[model samples]
Target: MEFSNRTRTGTHDSHRTEHDATRPGPMEEAAAVMRCIVCGHRAGYNRAVVDLATGSEVGGLCVGCECTAFGVSLLFGFRLSGSNCAFCERDGHYAIPSWRARTVETGGKTVSTVEYDVTEVTVRLCDEHLERLKRVAAAHARVPGSVRPSGPE
Candidate 1:
C-alpha cells in the first residue's frame, strides 16, 4: 500500500511490517509520509527523527529548530565548521557555547575561572525547540542537588 502525508486524527501505534525486497516496510512507509511538527510540511524527503522519550514522530525542522533540538557538543580545544545540528543532523542556524566555571583559592584569595566546556558545541534552535530547551534547562536548574560543586571544601 502507498503511504501519503496526512494528519491522522486518532491514536495509532506506528508499527513495522516486513515486506518483500521490492517493497518498503511499514516503518519505512510511515517515515516517508510523516509531516513536520513545526511547519506541517510533508517530510517525504526530509524525514525527521522520532522522539523516543515521547514516543512520537518529529518532522520539518528548520535551521533554528534543528539547532535548538540538537545543539553542539565538542571538546574544549576543537573548532566548529559545519552547519548541521549535533543532535538531529539538520541544518543549524546558531552557535551557542556552554561554559563551566570554577572558583579556587589563589594566593589566599578566592578567584574564579570559566572554561568553555562545550567549546565546539553550537546552539541552533528554532522558536519551538529553543523554548522547549530553555524550559527543560530551567526545570533542571530548579531541581535540588542537580548542580554539583566543582571543587571540594
Candidate 2:
C-alpha cells in the first residue's frame, strides 16, 4: 500500500497558506546499506560508474569489472516474477507494490556524498492472502472514497 500526505487548510492573520509550518519532519530513519546489483562494491553503481537512468559520469570500470558489461543489457524497470506469495508459499495471483524513499551513499566510506532514490518493492500474493489483505486494508482505511473492500467474485 502507498501513503500520501494530507494537508488541511489553515488561516494565518486571515490569510490562507498551503505550507504547514507545524508539520514536523522525521527525526530518525530506518535504512540499510544494500550493495548495487551490478557490483559488489558497497558504493559502486552511481559512484564508480554512471547510473544508466541518470547520466552522471562513467569514470571507469568498477572493482567488479562486470558492472557495465552486464548492467547495460538489463531493462530499465526490471523485477522478479514467478515467485511464491509474500505471506506464504503459494502461487501468486496478484502483484502488490509499495514504494519508499531510499538513499545510496557514494564517494566511498570516506566521503559523505549521497544520492536519493524512490525505491519500489513489489510482492506477490496468493488468492487467500489477497482477500484477507483486502479486508484488513478496508477496515484500517477510515477515510471515505478510498479503495473499497471487494466482495466475492
Candidate 3:
C-alpha cells in the first residue's frame, strides 16, 4: 500500500500523520521470499527457467499441514486463477521486479546501466487457505492483522 505523511493544523497544534492506501507494502515483497500461505512455512526454492518444464518441489514440508491440501486445490483447477510466487505459490505476496533500461551520457561517451526495482503486489488467499493461515498463525503466536510474529518462536 502507498503511504504518505500528511500534516494538518488541528485547532492549535500542527499534527503529522501517516496515511496508508489500499496497496501492497515492502513487507509483502520481502515475505514473498518463499513463504507458504497455507502453513506459513518458508524455504528456499529453485525457480523454473523455462515454461515448458514443470517446476521442482524439493523443500521439506511446511509448518502448516494445509499446504498439501492447497496443492490439491491447485491440481484440479479449483483455485481462482491468478499469478503467485513461483516458490511460495501465494498470489500477491511476490513482487515482480521491474527492470529500468536507460542510458546516461558520460564526459565523452554514453554509458548504460539496468536498474531493478521490486514492487510488491497484494495477493488474495482463498477463503479456506486464509482460515488455515489464521489458525497456523495463532498456534505460532502470530496476531491477526499483524503479519510478523512478535518474538522468536
Candidate number achieving the greatest lDDT relative to the actual structure: 1
lDDT of 1 by residue, 1-153 (tens): 111222322221233234343465443464446553443344332323333234243453333333333433222333444545444566543333432344555555444433222122333333345456546544544668754222211
CA lDDT of 3 in candidate 2? Answer: 17
Off by over 4 Å in 2: 1-82, 98-121, 143-153
Q: List the residue pairs that clash in candidate 2.
A: none
Local accuracy by lDDT, each model: 0.38, 0.34, 0.32
On TM-score, the leading prediction is 1
Weakest 10 consecutive residues of candidate 1 by summed lDDT: 1-10
Question: In terms of TM-score, how similar is model 1 to the real structure?
Answer: 0.28
Candidate 3, residue 70: how far the Cα is off, in Å: 3.0
Q: For candidate 3, lDDT tens digit of each residue in 1-153?
A: 221111111121122134332332332233245444334455212110111122222121232333322334432434323455433565433222222344555554444333332223212343344455547654654444533322212
Ranking of all candidate structures by their lDDT, best first: 1, 2, 3
Clashing pairs in 1: 36-59, 36-60, 64-125, 64-126, 65-126, 67-124, 68-124, 68-125, 96-123
Of candidate 2, the 10-residue stretch with the lowest lDDT total is 2-11
Question: What is the C-alpha local distance difference test score of candidate 1?
Answer: 0.38
Residue 26 displacement in candidate 2 (angstroms): 34
